[model samples]
Target: MDPSRSEFAIHEAAREGKAGVVDSLLNANPKLATQKDDDDRLPIHWAIANNHLDITSTLINTRNFDPDTPDGSGWTPLMIASSLKDNQGEQTVDLLLQKDVEVNAQSFNGQTALHFASSKDNLDIARKLIEHKASTRLKDKRGQLPLHRAAAVGSMPIVKLLLENKSPLNASDVDGMTALHHATSEGHGDAAVALLKAGAETDKRDMDGRLAIDTAPDAKVRKFILQSAEREGIEIVTS
Candidate 1:
């Protein structure tokens, strides 16, 4: 068999997540296991990304696949799992983690698994990542961390978990807007309150010198801010 032809077979098996085909080919030529496709995705990336748990298991356990292989987007199996939107994704994530995959690994966005998990509002996955000491301090391209993403989406459970994990509630984005600022501007009263309760400094102004209260979308939210400020004994001088 031509070596290039064998490489093509390996690539096909990898893309289809056919562990048996991949194993057969790999066994015939062990070097084929390391071959990458055009997108630089190894067989392991496809198996995990497609939720082929059996293939993934075979690749990891029997074939000793590298868990950290990055696809075209610099997304490892763990990073891809973090972005999963269904129970199968959850299962895949859990399986990978159980195999001791690097839980806090970052993606092209500079987001740890926790950041991506929170982006999907998967409390179970979020909790699992947090429990593994997934870095809450990591910021994505937007300079927003996992906690900021959770707060923006009004994911109460994930926000709570992130707060419990000591995520920086006051961490600001490029424009100097904190999670509380985002929550307030978007009229997510509960999320705003959560951030404030988590000790997010309400008085911290944004780049435009607007506090969280000034960004409230409506009077009800404005009232909540005023009340909260009063309760916290913070002074707000407004015209």
Candidate 2:
């Protein structure tokens, strides 16, 4: 294959977990190791994105391999790994973290790996990120903390982890909506219960001046919020 074709081939090999092909391509053109594809993604990004652990390792070992290099959308290998599921994703994350890549690196949207982990309900990944000192209080462009993302996605385990790590239960977003508001609005009764147990204020209002219970998607969620509020010595006032 031509040298230019080898460049594209390396990316394809990385994506397909073809470590031998990647090795040959890099050997043919050493600079291909750091070359960016059309999407501005290096071979490392492709390897990690596809959960090709061996290929990822080979790419990371290359000279000048920047694990924190952002793709066209400003997504780092860490961020991409966080968005994956299962043990492969976890292993990829561990590899990146071990390289001392920026654990709190944000994407174009200002979303950190913790934000992705929380939104995806990857409890173990979230725990690892927290252990690495990923700030739970950090917000995205929308001013949403990891806890807010977890609540919006109905990730009860993630919500619990964030709260245990001192994430503010009542932390509001740009819309002035807390995790409780997201939980109730999404009709996640279990998530709402978790937020309430963590002391999320039910009376807190969003930009629309609507409380969490007011946004409850159904009677079941409303009833749960009201009952939980009562247990916290708060009254639910309905007009």
Candidate 3:
């Protein structure tokens, strides 16, 4: 989306990682830090999304800055930071965590920061959120847990972490699919095996009346999961 004119200077600056320009803009008008862009996002949102910790910290220090402020989509800075590419979003995540914010705050879709982090396979951010006592069992609007998001993306470490943190091993979503279902359907053989090893029930069926293996995108995925289960001594009754 194009900037809505000169009012977006600080937003653009933060988005571009122009620390100096952001500082200058903030110095000129401290309120710019809290000003929402056409996208309904504050400068802090862009800074955190771009992984500019310096700019993020600067914006945080501004007067009356709401650390848990939601954007147009009701996503907090933590959610954006969690979804960043690569593994460089930790600094921003840490910075936001240090502030007075809701660690388990949900978005418009009831997605927590953990959901974003897990969906992107951001292990570090997920760990940080977990350390901060982020809930492993908070289901999204779709009734999907963070574990489901992690499994769908084949984020094994996150899946393990959530499981270790006592996220329900077989919680079904609104669609009646568990994390195992998500892993198998997405062809994440390793994830499916991990869930199975963690004791995900194989007999559970989805709303479509398909077992987890039956939801696999193709026969190859189903075969790999079945073979892996066999190697792990986990019997999967496909008959």
Candidate 4:
């Protein structure tokens, strides 16, 4: 180890997009390229998080780096890239995919890279993950898919994209609550409408045997769900 270099000097270089410095460190100590930060994030993890596409490519392709290594949060480099809110759009995501990063790798919550990408409303990231074989059907530990997260957060574009991916619109969570259940309960009427249009089973019941309308906290939400349900030729049972 270089006396002046901290344990995370490689990480710092990757995060700052100092490709040359990172190359030097990786060359001097190839193992340092894979060393985890305080958060258990390797230098590649920092590269993805910071959207250093060139550095990420160098680490992944040239170094034959491990892209599946998880961070302290059980998040992989792909997951970190998906969660990135910066980085000139999908440049980082695309680079990871080119290196064969596993898009469906799960975090501690069983949330895939797609989940984080959708939650961020990064259409480019989401699309890239999907294109790279991210499983749209895989749910988190709670049984909530990317669509459920999008619906709950009122991300219409993500909801639409997930629906287009043919995600099971009526797939339920651990509570047996479907994406519609979340959208209605969260008062996301527009999301509910989009879901219904995408063939989400509106009458699907939760573990409590309650429909989406039953959990709807407001009359407007209930009314919208009811309207969409009627249009979808499904019965809405509110208790």
Candidate 5:
């Protein structure tokens, strides 16, 4: 197979997990290994995006393969793996980390692997990224921290992990909404409780002057946050 004719074919093969085809294409022209498609994605990006571990491994081993190269959207292989929803994704992440890829590489949207892991509520992936030194405090384009993403998604375990790693508990976003506010607004009572326990300010308000308690999605959530504040000896005065 001519490498020029197989450009799209190679990417498709990787995406579909046809390792043999990818190998043939690479052997035909080693330069094909680093060629980008219209999406600015190499074979490796397609393989990682589709959770094709074997194909991903093959592509990463190719000479001059830029593992950290972002696609058209500025999403690195690590960032793509972090956003995956399967154990294969975790394995891909492990492989990338082993290769010493940038643990904290950001996308065009300024989202890190930790940000993606936290937002997706993938505790295992989040833990691995954290262990690899992925920053928990790095804010995205929205000025939202990983803690904010975890809280918004009601990821209590992730929230706890970030706190243990010294994530800023009361850090606010572009909206001036902290993790506590996100938890409350999303009706994540357990997340709210965890943030409060981690020293998130209950009285902290958003740009709208809405307190964390004020954003509670329901009465039950509001009551839970209020009770938690009472126990923390913090006053919950809403303006």
Candidate 6:
């Protein structure tokens, strides 16, 4: 009955994937659904964070449930769901989405569900979020867009998807690095090529005045970017 005892009974049940127990506990004390545990997370936050779809569904149906409620770091359940990497994650996203969850809610750092999906390279979730009207252009605290995260992680499909959704092709982050810069510097050749073909400015210079190609970590990636740029008729200009 102590709030400081690590977690609530319902939280333990949810984290451990005990669907039946979670249901019973919620029935006993529906307020448990909204009660913050030791981690400042509601029971549903744990359920969805652990990819327990059934528990997430149960928690969502509880009275006064707010799909937009955030955890300690301002990470909403939808953001957490987007970061998950399985079919259950999809189910969880769908479950919360049915409640008209705020797909665009940002965390403490201004990262939305789209940002998380892009960062995790979850194309399906990213697509789903986009369908729900999540913004592809929401920037994080560092001014890095979802497109930037996708490029940095070498997620070519995600990069393409965000671009299709109108992510600014040449948007720069706090470091003045564009998505192309991230892709090239991280050594993602295919992604770099994709960015270039999509009309990414080859001469975009970062804070250090380094071009996207100049930021490439090696001769191979640099060579690929140059070759791909040449093929696409995108002139590669140095800073």
Strongest candidate by lDDT: 3
Identify the candidate with maximal TM-score. 6
Better of 1 and 5 by lDDT: 5
Candidate 6 root-mean-square deviation in Å = 2.2
Residue 75 error for model 2, in Å?
A: 0.8
Better of 2 and 4 by TM-score: 2
- The local distance difference test score of model 1 is 0.76
Clashing pairs in 2: none
Off by over 4 Å in 5: 1-7, 228-234
Against the unseen true structure, what C-alpha lDDT does each candidate score? 0.76, 0.85, 0.89, 0.81, 0.86, 0.88
Better model by TM-score: candidate 1 vs candidate 5: 5
Model 5 backbone overlap count: 0
- Colliding residue pairs in candidate 6: none
TM-scores for candidates 1 onward, in order = 0.79, 0.92, 0.94, 0.84, 0.93, 0.94
1-239 in candidate 6: lDDT tens per residue? 64323448888888889898887777777788899977789988899889887888888988999999999999999999999864348888888889999999999999999998888899999999999999988899999999999999999989989999989999999999999999989999999889888888877788998888888898988888788778877887875
Lowest summed lDDT across 10 adjacent residues in model 3 is found at 1-10
Q: Per-residue lDDT tens digits of candidate 3, residues 4-79?
A: 2376888988999989888777777788888898889999998888778888888888889888999999999888
- For candidate 5, write residues 1-239 as lDDT tens digits: 76436548888888888888888888988898888898888889999888888888888888886668999999999988988874458988888888888988888889998998888888899999999888887888999999999999999999999999988889889999999899889999888887777777766789999988888778887888778778877676666
RMSD to true structure for each model, in Å: 3.8, 2.1, 2.4, 2.9, 2.1, 2.2
| TM-score between candidate 5 and the true structure | 0.93
Residue-level lDDT of model 4, residues 1-239, one tens digit each, is 66228768888898899998988887887888767778778888888777788888888875547768898889987788778774253776776677677778899999998998877777778887887778789988998899988888778988988888878888889999998888888898888778777767756789999888788787877887678778777665555
Candidate 3, lDDT over the whole model: 0.89
Which consecutive 10 residues in model 5 have the weakest lDDT in total?
Answer: 1-10
Q: In model 1, which range of ten residues has the least summed lDDT?
A: 2-11
